[model samples]
Target: MGRLRRKLKKTLIETSETGLSLELRLIGQFIIFLVTIMLCISLILVATGVFKAGMKQNIALFEKELSHLSQDIYDDFGNLSLSSVSLA
Candidate 1:
């Protein structure tokens, strides 16, 4: 009976230790997963921010070029009208 009791106690302790170890491993894995997700989100945000800035610069450049083109067209039309009136 004494030997049986000692053996049972030893088995119980090992089982409890295994359970605790599993719980710790699962918690560590969960923490790692959360960190990975956060890192991914941060990287995506940074990439989008850079893209947005580049787009803004491109839009501004295009607007400036378009304004210059329109001014040139208006001046050419005015000159053509004046020349036609003089010839008539």
Candidate 2:
């Protein structure tokens, strides 16, 4: 009877230990998953910010070129008008 009780006790301890280990493993996996999601979100935000900044810079450059082009067109028109009046 004593031997039987000892065996039962050992079995119960092993079962509890196994359950505890499994629970710990699941918790670790959950934490890792959460960290990965956070990292992905942070990276996406950083990339989007960089892209927005680059787009703004490109837009500014394009606007500057357009302004220069319009100025050149106006100057040419003025010169043409003067030459035509002088010829007439």
Candidate 3:
């Protein structure tokens, strides 16, 4: 009876060790997954901010160019109108 009990106890210990090792491995995998997700989120946020700044700069440049073009058009039209009136 004593030897049988010892054997059973040894078996239980081995089983417990295997379970603990598996649990530890699962926890480690979960931690790695969480860290990877955080890294991806941070990268996406940085990319979004950079894209927004680029778009704003492009918009400003377009507005400035449009204003210059409109001014040139107005000056040309004014000069033509004045010369036509003088001729008439």
lDDT assessment of candidate 3: 0.92
Q: Which TM-score value belongs to model 1?
A: 0.45
- Where model 2 places Cα greater than 4 Å from the true spot, the runs are 1-47
* lDDT, candidate 2, 18-84, per-residue tens: 7657778899999999999999998998888864768877999999999999999999999999999
Computed on alpha carbons, the lDDT of every model, listed in order, comes to 0.92, 0.92, 0.92
- lDDT tens digits by residue: candidate 3, 1-88: 9999999999999978776577788999999999999999989988889647688889999999999999999999999999999999
Q: What would the TM-score be for candidate 3 when compared with the true structure?
A: 0.44
| Candidate number with the higher TM-score (1 or 3) | 1
lDDT of candidate model 1 versus the reference: 0.92
What are the TM-scores, per candidate, against the unseen true structure? 0.45, 0.45, 0.44
Predicted candidate 1 versus true structure: per-residue lDDT over 1-88, tens digit per residue? 9999999999999978776577788999999999999999989988889647788889999999999999999999999999999999
